[model samples]
Target: MKFKTSLIALSIAAAITPSLVTAEESDIEVITVTSSRMDKPVSAIPNTVTIIDREQLEQQFRTTKDLSTIIGNLAPSFSPSRQKMSNTGETLRGRPPLIMIDGVPQSNPLRSGGRSGQTIDPAMIERIEIIHGANAMHGLGAQGGIINYITKKATGDNEHQVSFDVTMPNNLESDGISFGTSYSFSGESDQLDMIGSVSYRNNGVYYDANDQMIGVDTTQGESMDSQSADFFIKLGHNFDESRLELMVNHYNMENNGDYMAVTGDKENDIPTGAIKQEQPWEAANNQVTTTSLTYTHEDIAGQQLHLQFFNQNFEAVYGGGCWSDFYDPSMEGNDQVTVCGTGDNGESLYYEQSRNKSVKWGMKASMIANNIAESGINLAYGIDMFRDTTEQDMVVSGASWVPESTYENIAPFAQLDYDLIENLTLSGGVRYEYAKLKVNDYKTMYGYGDKEIQGGSPDFNETLFNIGASYQINPSIRLYTSFNQGFGMPDIGRVLRDGDSFPDENPSIDDSLALTPIVTDNIEFGADYQGEYFTAKIAFYRSSTDYGSRMVEKEDGSGSFVVKREKSVIDGLESNITAYIGDYDDVGVNIAIQNGEYDSNDDQSVDTDLDGANISPNRINLFWTHNFDNDISTRVQANFFMDKNFKDASDEVYSSFDGYTTVDASVAIPVYSGTLSVGIQNLLNEDYYTYYSQTVGKDTRYFKGMGRTATIGFTMPF
Candidate 1:
């Protein structure tokens, strides 16, 4: 019975949305046996798990390589893309998830720069696995969930592939054109396997529906007028009882600053526009390099042992503007009036940019013992250790925006799984974390009143646990429930950089509100049903945290300021249904319904509904796919976001978020021994602002969605 249910996932290989899973717990082959850090069946995963296989991923890649867009369309609970380089406001289940690649962390939770998603090109990835609720399985920073990108391996037969894709707006103008090219190869010889790939993309200027130039998001990052490249390689050797693999990945995205953003009138529905310029914005870039070596032994005293060591280097640059907080770095006394000289009207001009830089290295060692004591019980135990050094520095001024900070963490965990009976399974795990952060005292920024700020080492000790149960309700249905806890750190850099957060005279080192760690606990239950022609799933979850972080835009509009607030509660439901017509045709619908609120008055009671900044409105996606006799396949999907309106604790209405809709379609046909694919974005040319732009209501960042566009690609495998 379970084996039949597992066939659903293998059969619906091209499901575009977050769809059904393969319940191959013990009957069918383990579908998720690679790159999962922990070797286990998909059923062992407690919460909802969405697997985006290569087929669906390539189908999405036909339209756009922007991972955020792909995720928004595929993942049910993922927030809408901000349509910028930064992933800010792109929370999962109302909280930031831990983003990783090949079991290596890519997210910088300490500073929270929101650039994790773009660390690697999607072309190098073979699949994506998302765990829907908070958990400590991956160690730190899973307050929301986990998004792990599994890279392609070199274990297949000798193969080589090359592909090129080009995209342009409906007008077919040269300015709004983009192109990408990639070459990849994999070969297996004897005991050795090797794989490598290189890819490059160039994006031209972007235009809105009105045929106006879209403003460049210099502040975060932008895809417009940018160049991105990726290089990846992995080598592995198989031993009689062990396997060793070494991998390296280098990625870079640099924005070409060729225009200046001109603010618009939000009240009048005018979008921010851009004008051509040759200014120097070389500072706008994201560079990441990661390397890891893994060794696994299957015969270690009748147990499996996995060991890995990894290192990552990251740097990100944000646009600089002459704000009141910026000071001339050449001056010794923090003179504020230097970079952008006074204008004719005695107003400040734009000046310097800032960069977030960090280096991280970590190691993990784990052992799994099956059939412990012949009781049909399994135990998986491991220890994780990592260190990260992070800081934010001024790009042009060569000054420090946030002082150098170092963090160290060591954790040990144990997980147990047992089939209590033939029809019931129980799983539990525990992890203990010991962490420390060190920062030296430094003078505050000019906006911080030039006072000497005190910095000290802050340490933490925490323990998190998760438990789950699953019961087979006959052959075609399975029920699961879980309680999971996660731990994370606030965006310490936000408060530390703001001088206003500290008081004068004997300012104590303790600022619990902004510096405390955040802990979240989630309770979830769901059911899965697999039938001959119908597959469906539904999950409900409630998550809460005593101390959570929230961001509020400043009055001057320089940017947003972060604060640690009271209790926050998030409740949501995710469900999807798909009907199949034979093997090559299917129709599906997925919906995510969520609402979040927090205690605004600090009175120990929830009072305010979270705004768009922290939560996403309800969303739905509908799609259909068909394959004809001529080996031609076509897929179409439409996404809709419902309107959202909420108020603060004070009863002031904020963020009257109007809903919007977009449609996309793609087709692939066999041509000359290769596949020729074409994709259309905004097929109906529905003009609208992004959810972020519509909710924020800021003129400078009031960005409109992209206009109608088309993409063409050709792929050949040899």
Candidate 2:
């Protein structure tokens, strides 16, 4: 591990040193980020943020459709990619970040089923904005900040335009051939503009470097042997001083693999594989539909006003039942009986499928005023309200895993931007939130003896604040600092499902089962240097919480888990440097280092450092790109992960992950009013294991990463 770390460090050092020449004038376009209520230039913002434009996305993320993998590569603070459909252990700075599409939240905060990261297809995204560290602007679920995906918009004066794109694997293997196609039409008139697109993709089976079938994890919604479709439409009309816009997006994805997992021998370095099997009762499915309406008034009594209303419907289903234990009344003393597929009558029963459904609606209204009272102050205030109902159940048995529950939240926030001096600016915000949850009485499932559980109504209220300042010392140098607060509620469903005694049997339900919210305080300091040929950024941040939420595995082998709260602290450093050598070539390097600790014994003392489950290992990314004169471009990239020991070494259930590096390359060429691209993923064919597969103790989850695969794609416009 130590030798591998040193090798990676040397490689990164060699790649950056040669291009660290003197700065010169360059023609870099300015990027605007919408992290705040208003769109501000990235150079002027005090927070650490990264913006990936359409060009970058098309060039860098053409080979893979995983959003987590794409974002993790570009952002330093973000954890390494899971390379799967589910983002179970992916975190930003040791905590989960809020995901949004067009300013509408997509994360299921109530249950957090680990499917939020895959809510939308990469083909539908126009740009992605990521804000690092804790923030209060977005209210709940922003404990580690926000990642907002902006959809495409109509452009140009053309009355009508069409575009088509197709991509497929170049490998000859029939089972490894994946294909996707998309068609889009956009038009703009004097007063109206509209854009719409429909896309469908069919994925083939996945194999490792050894040409062995990858293991199927029904619980994680594996993408292999799956099909997905996306539909999107947006329309906007302009008035003299007001504008109205509407958007609708639908996405459906499901896994229909014909194979089941076969556990491996981890001690012997053997990976889990798949074998042919009969189809289960239900395959893993993820579907979502969203609709939104937005209205904006440019000049309303010298204040700009914006109003938006949105609704979303979502459902996700997992694989069939594995194994569980239940109390059997047929026994003399009601002894617990373990069952895999047989019922009380010793007859075979269909495997039970677990699923969750959610319906959410929300509204937001905000107004911005400039030069308030001639005090050189810009003020922005907003009100947000949302209602969400979610439920979890077993389809085959009609049993409840999580009872139907409704969550209502209302928040009011205000932000101030003050021009402190000629080159310095000060910004601050405050927000107050009120939330309520209501649940009805329900009976536990077979696993819990089918006991009736009492329901309750709970309310939570909190106030959060943030402040920051940025100073432009020179034309090419800027310094910034910020202190922000963010909060998150516990997964109530997890708490309720672990109920051991009913309210009647344990009268102190409120005190014994009620979970508390977690509040985080983050402090960050950073500096940026932008020049014609060289650009660099460095940031350091620390976040602490009196109570933090985490998932703990169950000892009963049911593959179920519960959420718990404890004291936690996390701190990290991020740095990135990019140098452009002339007009055709560029080199870049990014590094991230993080550490986390928690009070495991609840003695007010931090007793253990966090493992891969909570914190990501140190990582470094390096890349170089060159553009030829004939409209051809090529890029080579590498990512390195450093070795680390798991925090819970005393627990035999934990495993330590070994460090490894991977390489990738791609080429793009322009042809006949279109672009043709060829890419090789896992160019080195490292034959390594994923972070989750390496660190997980169980054999069922042990699997190797994807092998080297070639892809070819083309896009044309008419």
Candidate 3:
């Protein structure tokens, strides 16, 4: 399956590239409000873009188990599950991408576990805009790409709407269940109009044909649940022939889940008394809460102002008898170690509770103006400021081991977009950021050392810039090129610990080390066309960097224990085509392909050429949608991912996961002036894995995706 997926990806790329060269122009124009903070047509922009409408989102969510699956199916090889299964972490175009809600940044690089950004209820989303390639105009740190989530706003009509859903499966009838409902009310009696919505969702773990737990542990009988609420209010007044408006929005989410991990071995009177490294169990719990508020005004002097604030709290705890409070030096290397004179997997013998906290705040304001009275030129500028702080502490009941340390960053930037020629657009932007870090005074574990290690305030100041231009070859086609810079600073927790190296019996030397920032220079070229029958886009990018992040190996050179800095380069290509086949029926099809690779890497240090390396090389997404009549319609989609290569040189072993394709079909039927949807996902009952990783000398699996799911939902209009 993996090999076939890869081949199909290559074939799709080969086909889309040529189609881009021959794409023609279309007359339909869709207005966008993100790039310029004002309404503008997509064709007027200088970049490749993809928009996911509300209908598409509803169709996917109704059939899939979670949003993670939606992301993986749409973009080949892009998996959120990879964060837990793979140690190296997942990146787009060889680097971490940026995520934004409305116009606010949600990425906190200093947060533990690297889980940034908040999840939104799909029913509240109006549309999603995806911008491929480096985003210099959006400010620094956007090396790979950007995703902007634009949610639904308020309406003035005095009406309410609600939606609800329930799911079914091809196999286990008792194990599958899900339901959510949303309500919206609007009125126009006073100067203010408002809309409020609340949603709740819950789902049990899914099992595959093999009767395996998939990603969950049957021992825990775990499940996931989430609750969200959103509200928007718009107040406006008419003065003479002009009007002024004010818009405010607020969103909140609370989620909780249990996580599963593989422990070594479990046996009565186990040697080392520490469970063997291959036993699987559900031992951790995660809870997160996020809140955001925004205020904005539009149509004011070709200028707009936006202010946003966000706060998120996350907590993770190891549960059960496995999480005890005790440290016995005698348990170092012995199999039959004692924890308070009793045998308990290293927990009671040597364990400590860990907790992490993070806070982030940022705001941006931008303006756009045209030289209507000057040289017929257009200009755009914006300034932004952001700050983030994090702290982690290890606690055992009432006692503390690792002290709490904090890291913070302050950044401010400005950008300009100008029309240098009649048919060309030029842009330049720069950001200067300063980071401050401090480690609170603390004592070493086990009284191993007396003197506390104080992290000297390490500060970093960086300047990032980019230049780009777009040329209008004609009304049907446009060419664009850009050169930009990207950077990422060393994280707070890893900044102090250098991993195991240089000694086993040193009490005076500080084990923590400070690292430097990694930067990259990226160049890109792309073209877009809107023809009579089809719309196509193709882009190529190259990234060269002096410093890169990779896993570091121990002295024995058998495995990895640390993340080291290296130098490398990456290049890739992306292309897609959308065709309108019929006018009477309004039928259309869309296809996309993406390829990427690392030109140079230092995986040999960890004993593998493929470790810490993954490129889609090829991906194919196909969608067919038709409007059968005014009130009814149907759609079908197929997503395929190529097989990826995983090799560990030290172990002298190579493994590859076969790729598979997922087929989805859906239909909308109008009942009593309401919309009813029915859909089937994974229609072929194809069992495929989304991630693969090694644990304790053997390979383990997280999920096999979903076999087959059927959903029925209804949206009512009062």
Candidate 4:
């Protein structure tokens, strides 16, 4: 009864439920030792951790295949889904997180493509691990935390599945119809194991509650009116004292909609819309391929050894623009006509688009040693090295927007765990990072006057530390605290490409504002209680930095995004609890509340509150899952976003956002030969603007969330 808080039960909503961390076993033990950076029980780790296992993933899959939606509902701190391919406004802990796939980094930190969250399909994933807080354990770009998607593993028994799914809005319009199919297999023979999967999905056009066409996000890319495919393969072999594994994955998505955006009037509350029309440029697209090889050896001179090598290749093309000073030439069935928006033959409105391409390669090695000479102590150490080359260019104009930049980094880290008392463990770790970025001279595109900027080589050296202690109060409860530091670099590409920012007097990257490396310090206190019929976890955290980059819209009215570095602080509380209602039913509630502000004018005072693009709104969620006779199961979830207002304490722009609530439900039944599934998203058909569109207050980007939707799926195991 350590978690008896009856007074708050009336306001209870569930972000953590049976759909999130459902363990078949009742004993509290190590869930998984893969993504913690160290092999230990979560109770021994001093930081708050969130683990989503396959059962949870499967439950979400029955509703929708959107990765962001699945994560947003499972984790309280995650931002609401933009319902798009680009993760522009998706921030974790009011900051960007380093996303990885089975130990391979997928985030393009050098350039902001905003496609890191969609690198892999959920069908190929077995579980997800999220380490909440600022830390350098992953070596770079983990300002908020680390999210690792662990791939499925091959079991001793050979098994396979084939599935087909379809989703659409409640109206059942043809344009709202979407479909997908996938096949996966796991096989093992003696010491060899293998797993493979291929999946494809074509998303239909989206619609709001009013049955109006949702505006397309041509600038950052969109999930509506798009088609995507994913393929993955993994192989492993076990030897007497060593093991080896290889993994490869390829994914691509492209929009082929013949439509144009219709800007709206936010003041009058007219949401953005879309119409059928010929587009001026190539459709937006994204493609990614990753490869990794890993080796492990046990009892290597009394230490466990592990090594990994990985490579990632990525490319994306954005939608064409129709703004002033941008030349428009590629109109379908028309010559290179520049007449765009009130311009005649003589007056040309310059319209252009860009593409992002990057390649990353890296290697990591770590070793673990325990109880040296029979002492009650343990240690783990590792080293990581990586190099990335990235560039952006106008797809049609053949002009470089951002010069090719190569980043090289090498970091070594070590962690020690010591038992200070019978029930208390002290842990400490430190990492040193050495990085160099080399950029060549390049010219900015139209709008900034096509200015030529000189590029220089910038290098950084940083030492980061993390220390924590966990004390077990009893068999069912534990308390912990931690202090950690994280190192991050803003995408210099944004600064280099901004022709308007470079003055006529200066032309070098060395003196560029907002180009400094960001180092954040974070502290947290947490407690966890695990019982047979009740479970609860809660954490309070605060992070601050004298200088750090925050994402913001460009003030030049180009409808582009940029980064601003200033003093900022963020503090929040996250908690979750689950109570078994009976033998086959469970109900739960969870809440996420955070506040963030920054020194907008660089005066060193955090006076202005952060916008929705940087921080998620406070949320309360309720969820319940029940099992019935004949192995049938059902789940229902409801999430509410609390309204918020920003106080103008500084010179930055301010706006208020109204909140809304949405519900989702799903059920599974055993059919003749397979499982039949059905789900309803936004079951109440609530109509509302997204957090970003409401808070940013830009007419062109003001958009509404999705309306009610229904999906059906069937799974056949062979």
Which residue pairs clash in candidate 1?
A: 322-350, 322-351
Instruction: Show where candidate 2 strays beyond 4 Å.
Output: 1-30, 159-171, 325-350, 501-504, 507-509, 512-514, 649-654
Q: What is the C-alpha lDDT of each candidate?
A: 0.81, 0.76, 0.51, 0.82
Please give the ranking of all candidate structures by TM-score, highest first, separated by commas: 4, 1, 2, 3
In terms of lDDT, model 4 sits at 0.82
Give me the candidate number with maximum lDDT.
Answer: 4
Instruction: List candidate 4 segments past 4 Å from native.
Output: 1-3, 6-26, 325-347, 504-506, 650-653
Question: Model 3, residue 678: displacement in angstroms?
Answer: 1.2
Q: Rank the models by lDDT, top first.
A: 4, 1, 2, 3
The sequence of per-residue lDDT tens digits that candidate 2 reaches over residues 202-295 is 8887777777777878666778888899999899999999999999999999887577888888889888878877456578889998888999
lDDT of 2: 0.76
- How well does candidate 3 score on lDDT at residue 383? 60
User: How many clashes show up in model 1?
Assistant: 2
Model 1's TM-score against the true structure: 0.94
Number of clashing pairs per prediction, in order: 2, 1, 21, 11
Which has the greatest TM-score? 4
